[model samples]
Target: MTTLGHKSSMDHHLTGMSDNTVERPGERAPLVLNMDKFSQVTATVCRVSEAERAPIAWYICFTLSLGLLSVLGVCIGYLFLTGVGVWGLNNPVMWAYDITNFVFWVGIGHAGTLISAILFLFRQKWRTGINRFAEAMTIFAVICAGTFPGIHVGRVWFAYWLFPIPNQMEMWPQFRSPLLWDVFAVSTYFTVSLLFWYTGMVPDLATLRDRAKGKLQQLGYGLFALGWRGSNRHWHRYERAYLILAALSTPLVLSVHSVVSFDFATSQLPGWHTTIFPPYFVAGAIFSGFAMVVTLAVPARELFGLKDLITLRHLDNMNKVILATGCMVGYAYSMEFFIAWYSGAMYEKFAFMNRAFGQYWWAYLIMVSCNVITPQLFWFKKLRTSIPIMFVLSIIVNVGMWFERFVIIVSSLANDFLPTSWDSFTPTWVDIGTMVGAFGLFFTLFLLFCRYLPMIAMAEVKAVMPQADPHGAGAGKHGHAHH
Candidate 1:
């Protein structure tokens, strides 16, 4: 079975997917992945390369991604080989890069799930184009965000100490400890996200199987597709499953970030204690997540010749979200400030003031300018649609969001209640290098995903297409209605 879909030299349906020369097991009906541009069961996998550089750009992006992953691997391995002493961490400041990086990555995970799950519930049909990729980003960013905390404990093998195993020593994990709570939260977050992402991939994998060329490709895609034929019955069940998943994910999104915030709020430490922490962390997570989505998607859209599919309209809509969430996050910052002063706690007052005018004051101001002020550009339609402007702003947002975590963690902890215990922390090259390396871990995986997986959710996209709604144009005339 050398059946190739696109007639390309490389991708032939070689090993896995055929019952005969011209017919398949379900040839009596239409195969889901063989759909046309207007397909009600498949997305338009027809990306145009005339105005974009798909392969060349892939080369460049993957190279950079691989380099970053290598750096991250070395940094982590070195952290273990040399011990925790390699980093700038000390007592009272023990939560430095470990916690900051955790929050930063977890925050990065929020936007993708929000865009896919929340917007879907709202009937925002436009999410079809980028939602698949965005969800994939959510899963991967969580993977990257999660790795740091595990290794940050210095004894990488003993990372399991965070968990309660009911072992021989009668050493129960402390229920009162926020760190233990973080263990439950992050593990649950990862499991839920994985389930959400994989369930969505099934229909898209069916599309890939139909589009496959060679026996090998066919077999590989066929297995991954899990025998999907996209019958009406399947779509009915699929849609139901998706809706249920969305409902389930909404709470997880809110709870995960809120729980992460509690890792700080539950602390008796001056800067760490705050009542508004949960909602504040959630807002910041969404804000940063959207910015990151914009940053990655802009490049992917341009490079992959998906301009029409990922139109400027999509960008404009995302800009609006980024602005809205950014504003909410900014308000959270203001609320923190107000709470600190209103509490009249000397330790709290000092923590807030020192963060602004102290040794690490610049990080705070940078966070303010980038997240609070820069997103204001979205007020202009021109800025919202302009790729160059969006690209720069997106990058700035990432930088600002990273600083938000840094300011919250490092600055707050650097100088605590005891003046004698106060000391400024700086990121060593290893810390900076490893942090930089995580980007590699992210991009490399993303690049591979785009090539193999249909970047668009084919079935979901088709389901939302105008004709897919049987009552579309014939509504009143035919005594029915469009979706």
Candidate 2:
């Protein structure tokens, strides 16, 4: 039957009215391709990771990322030998690039859980194609996020003091401090996200294990597969556990960024002390996270030659999400200014003004243009559908998000109430190197993931294809096996 006929039949079935049209069994709209057989879907996605040799581009990118990792090491070594004085941080602007990069990376981690958990609960089957990689990105981004705070404590050896573990000093973390709350919140977020990512990959690993060509491949994939046999009983328990994890992660997506905001909201700094920080930071987190996903996925689909699995429809959907969250972030930006002016608090008003017209107006412009204006183009269907445009905009969004943190951190601190203590901040080479190194760390892990693990979840993608629906009209009627 034609696609239109199937739609009409579906409408008729829902309305329970006889339309005099022939309703055929196994008829449904194709989500990705016209002939999406299970075998083909599995072959296409799994082929990338299981190939005898990875693409040359993978080696090139991995090499570059490794160099960045090395740069991060050198900068960190310098930091240990010298001190925080190597950076431009001083006086009122003590919290500068380090905290900004920390928050930026944490925000980048938010989209993975949002896509994996919230969308799964809503039964958005489209998420099945991208959630695996996005979850991987989340884990990597969180790792990058955690690095800054650990190093920022100034004494790496004493970092264990942040935890509640018993130490030779017999000192416990200050439970009342929000900073300590951050330690707990971030660690919990990391732990749960890791579990969620690993659980979802097991079935896919089993698929890889079955397809392995070499004994070593079989052994490695088999080790991670945990003897998954794809039995009905295994699937039943897996589904239940997956549902429970999704439910748990939904709130963590919201709470993690909110708690990160609390690190500032609980403070008395002029720009930081605001009730709107929680929701504002959450929206911004999702906004930046989706942008990063697009940035990674656009190039990824092309490089891996998995365009069919990660189709233009998927890209368009992600762009629409970026647009929505971008608007939310823009609304928050305006609201901050409005509330600042309306409250008649001179300090709040001054803080906002300094952010716009003060010494760091250039950073403010980049933040506004990238975060607010750039995403506006996605409102046009043509633009969002265009891969080149989406890729460029995605990068722009990431850069804008980093500057947003910079503006918030540096601008607020540089112009505090006591002008005598206030001083403008400038980042030293160590600051720039550390931030670049964080990117290295993130991409290095991501590259390793792409090479070793399934970059796309084959089984989940198969589960979402047209043939997966046992009751759909096209299921058994087509030359495809019913699940």
Candidate 3:
């Protein structure tokens, strides 16, 4: 119904649908399948949301997630009705499952912002296919993460005390406290991430609005689309806002994790006190985040029939990132040991030794093998490119990262300088159930998102299409010269 005379030509050129070939020289392997038409792209991505019924796997996963979420709820409710004593928290091991799960989910959220903000700033076009889903993952991961620290306070009702609220009592949070720092950092991150996600989604929502068949669908999408009308002015404004959000988000990716690390770094604990924690935590966060993305995306692309858009090339690229970050994490692990030994501090040296050969030696070994050793499989093209291998490895990476937190939190506190105060910690059923429930919560939100929202950003994907680039070399071949 809209004018396509000029746009159709551009689309044809960009999509490589016309005689004027848009293929770059030495076009090695196709990133996307050769079908690059704008209409096809739209049809492929939007079809999921607009489908008559979701795939059976979606229902199966959704139902399972709900069941697990219920378990989490029960666990939390029990904790509230009783007390923090329901957990296995002892004197030396006060932080166990709660802190471990908090750090794990927080780490999981990093890849989304890194891909959405950092990669976007760097002009990584491959990110287009996966950014939307990864951002959603980030948001859900943060929600799951935030739930932990809130409940970890024991008296959930007084959790608001962590916030700086001006009231009759006039109590304010201590700015110097690392815990308070986390509150501000995580809250700011969640806000900006949500805004960035929603802003990017607007134009695509507009596409849905225009294409919606039912009146309710049209109304729902129209309300959120903000009256987008494909005008050049609207496009210009949208791009500017998107750029600003991306720029803002880039530093946040670094800062949020850095602050999270400060919770440990500022401490006097042997294993926790270190200068390398910021970059080390950041690297580990990105490593785990990418693994989670791959884990989710591999199944999703297959089950959702999005193979062309979320291609093997995309998976391969993500695996490369996982490998790179995994190496960084491995290096950090090695450096930590070396630094401890060289520093000539008895407590520091013992802390490193205790971690590797202490009562929790199995946990440390799992962390090292999973985080450091497993990802080296990616050096082979066949392994990185193989979806099955990458998916399994991704899950392993998450497991390793979780244990990494456990090793740091429990191992350090359990065998500190004073041997008499040292003790081993075991998680209660409540602790286990609550941690498991966090996964349920994360997947539940993700499943609902996949069911309702466009898993892929259509407009952004289209923008990268050849026809969308008016001044490309291919445009000149199409009797259209760039001014």
Largest lDDT belongs to which candidate? Answer: 3
lDDT of 2: 0.87
Per residue, candidate 1 scores C-alpha lDDT tens digits across 236-317 of 8888988998998888899999999998888887778888889989988888888888898898877765564566667778
Q: lDDT per residue, candidate 2, 1-483, as tens digits?
A: 222224453453245332211225765323445333578777777878878888999899999999999999999999988888998999889899999999999999999999999999999877877899999999999999999999988888888888889767787778888898899989999999999999999988998999998899899999999999999998999999999999999998899999999999999999999999999999999999999999999888888877777777677888989999999999999999999999999999999999999999999999999999999999898898898999999999999999999999899999999989988998899999999998999999999998788888787877776445555534454533446
TM-score, candidate 2, is 0.93
Better of 1 and 3 by TM-score: 3
Please write out the lDDT profile of model 3 over residues 1-483, one tens digit for every residue. 122335543343345321221335644233345455678888888898899999998999999999999999999999999999999999989899999999999999999999999999999988999999999999999999999999999889989999878868877779999989999999999998899889889888888898999999999999999898889988788789889999999999899999999999999999999999999999999999999999999999988888877877788889999999999999999999999999999999999999999999999999999999999999898898887899999999999999999999999999988999999999889999999999999999999989778899888877776555555423535445536
lDDT of 1: 0.78
| Candidate that would win on TM-score | 3
Pairs in steric clash, model 2: 25-473, 26-472, 26-473, 26-474, 27-473, 27-474
Superposition error at 2 for model 3 (Å)? 19
- Runs of candidate 2 with Cα error greater than 4 angstroms are 1-29, 473-483
